[model samples]
Target: MTAAARYAALLQWLRSNDADISPKIDLQPSSRGGGYGAFLTEDAVEGELLFTIPRKTCITLADSIEDDACGEGFKALIETAGPGGNTVVMAGFMARERIRSLESQKPGSIVDDSSFGPYLATLPWERGMNNQEHVLYWDNKDIEKYLKGSMCYGEALDLRKEVDVAIRVLNTIVGKSIREFRGDYLDSGFQWPWEKAAQASEEKLKGPPEGLAEAVKGAFVCMLTRAFEDGDGDEEKLVPMLDMLQHSDEPNISHAMRKSDGAVEVRARQDLTAGQELLNQYRSELEETMPYHRFFTRFGFVPGIQEEMTNLFEDKSSIFFAQKAEI
Candidate 1:
């Protein structure tokens, strides 16, 4: 589908989300920047809840093990992962779901879709205006060219290695087919959804590793850029359209997970204009909290924090790192 068409489908699915929770926002091509953004059609006051997503609605690794979707061994793996291994656990869950979606689409079952299919459909597996084109997928040359000498270069490299290891570990536990399926899926330029990928599997493509690569990378991206800390536990979870709102240095909306119901809510940080795009600043206003290179590599764009600020504090990060390491 075209970019607009894809966004249209996503918007339709999001709109059908609980009317009381979903905000009245327009998903249009961003003139302010690349990809689609959430724009308010009506003026909203500061401190007002723009949207709220019930915690249970979110698809998390907790759901994966509990729902019996993942195998017992995989469930044990998730338990072992805990807080530090959120990426591995979530990635496994997503990979598992993709396989289930494939099975459901087979001959006799022909099931419609999974509970998270709509949300899964919205994930950016292929290159698009607002899809998966993370540093994890970047060719090494691109990394060297764009990120060399930057703070995030090493971090990005390390991240890619981590994902590679995660994929391999899953391969050992699940099957080599997951990796093979991912290889073929990547070879196909990542355009295929579950049904398309499933058809390829039928054609002798690997099965267990179906969607493994994308799922792991996608989960990691979401974890780094969008996932939230859940109140019920230390587990990180994603809140649909809320996660889709792009970040800014000075955001107009502030989001937090409600302690009462484990629901997440995004409130206006300031009075917003009727047609303004909802900006959600990913980091705190504390200048030291967000290093420019980290932002660029993690979210795939520089915050354009300006040269003066960079000059002032750039040396400090290295100094701090050295001190912290006592090097």
Candidate 2:
């Protein structure tokens, strides 16, 4: 299916599930060059409601633990891993749901497409325009070549190791010895959704699926890059339309989850014109003040760094030397 079809399905499914989406806005290719963004189709005043995703539709850690297939295993994982396990459970849920989505496409299959399938279908597994490309996916060689001497270099290495461990943990849950294949999914022996056709029959393909690890990794990347904190708990939620907006320093939109019903709402922070691409500021004022290297390690991109004029790592080390000299 085309990207437009996938998006249309998402909106249709959302509205059917009681999400209140504004007629004035729609998802379109972002001019910012990072996949799609919500665009205002007509002029709107500040405080106008853009969208409200129902609480049930939000993908949460609770849902992961309650899931029939992996719930018990995930519960054990969380109990053992403590707070950090929340992220692991969510990523596992995403991986399971994605596989179910693919399975649901089969004729007369007992498995049904998950309610989260529509939204999951829209997610990018292989990075393209989507900001799905993250530092975690970078190789150690590249990390050393490009990030060396930068403050984030160590952070990047640590993140890579963490994900490797996470994948191993996920292996115990999925019952497959899934390995990461940096190359194409076909080379990895899995038929991804993007593949035109599977070389094997449906029955043969089900002989323990390939790429579960890759799916887990992709979901982990999504959780890191897209999820928003749920105010009630340590868990984060994958809020649908709200996450579609690209990040910016001067965002035209703001969002809050309603404490009463757990619904998430996004609104215009300023008067917006027709054709304006809605933007969201991922970090708060305090978060924005964090060290630039930490920011890059977390979000995969740094803001406001004029790389041509400054080497922040070198500059930082120079400042340290100067301070020592003064002593």
Candidate 3:
């Protein structure tokens, strides 16, 4: 299917998800023509409900484990990891399921195969738009060229280190459980893509599925860009339409936990005129306001970052070649 067709399918899926996406807002390809965006079709006032998704439909570890399409491998991870591995479990579930979707794609197949494929399609998959900005996904040259001397440069360095440790923990600790739990899941056909990519380096004998490292990145990316607490303290979950909203330094939506249904509900923060893009407050405050380097490293764009900083990326290849990346 074309990108337009896929977007339509995702909208169709969202409409059928036992929730009400307000007709006042329409989901369409963003004006930038990269990922989808939510736009207002009619004027909306503060406290108006834009949509209300059921708590059950939200993707969580419990949902992943309950679904058979996720396979027994992911369920095993959940049973073994307990609270310590929620991030890994979510990552593995998404990665394996995503690979299944990719492998299942045909020359003209109009459908996505994974259980959550429709929702997944709404997210940005390529490097630049969202994933490339974060330090975890940065190429070495881009780091020096675009990120160095910025406030986020150090964070990019730190997150790169975190990915390294997460990969190590996934391989040494989680991989052991995965291997022992459902050894078949790690077989050649189902194994992640990292090992093949990692073979060029001296780390081949390290016994980690090079894919696990990438999975950690995938999980972290999902967490960084989307996950919100389910109002049960720090339990983060990925909500469908809510995750698709573009980030804005100055937001127009008010987010709150719905007491009645347990859904993270959003209301119009102020009066919104028709045809405006619905912006979600991602990070604000002097300390929390996302710096350009961190924005590039995490979400792929920096909204209103300085022109001098982004100019550095023009001279270098934006594609990051993954190695055992260390700062």
Each candidate structure's TM-score, on Cα atoms with residue i matched to residue i, is 0.73, 0.79, 0.70
Identify the superior model by TM-score, candidate 1 or candidate 3: 1
Write model 1 residue lDDT over 1-327, tens digit each, in one string.
566676676556655665234355777866445667788888888898887776666766567556542456567775687655656766666765665555566667644456666666566543443644468777788666655565666888999899888876665444533433334433355554886657545543343344666666666665666676645465777777777787777889887777777677888899887889888777653567566556655665555433332342355445113334455
Cα-based lDDT at residue 103, candidate 2: 69
Per-residue lDDT of candidate 3, residues 1-327 (tens digit) = 666777678767766767677889787776633567789999998889998766765667776566554435555655776775676667666655554465457566444477678777655543554323455666788777765655556777887776676666445434443333333334345435676455323233456653556656766777777887745574678887788787776888877767787676778988889998888866662445554445665655556542333464553323222224578
Q: After superposition, how far is residue 321 of candidate 1 from its true place, in Å?
A: 16
RMSD of each: 8.7, 8.4, 8.5
Query: Tens digits of per-residue lDDT for model 2 on 17-52?
Result: 999999997888878755788898999999999899
lDDT of 1 at 216: 67
**What's the number of clashes in each of the models?**
1, 1, 7
Q: What is the overall TM-score of model 1 with all chains considered together? A: 0.73
Worst 10 residues of 1 by lDDT: 304-313
Highest TM-score against the true fold, candidate: 2
Candidate 1 global CA lDDT score:
0.64
Which of 2 and 3 is ahead in TM-score? 2
- For candidate 2, the C-alpha RMSD (Å) to the true structure equals 8.4
lDDT at 40, model 2: 88
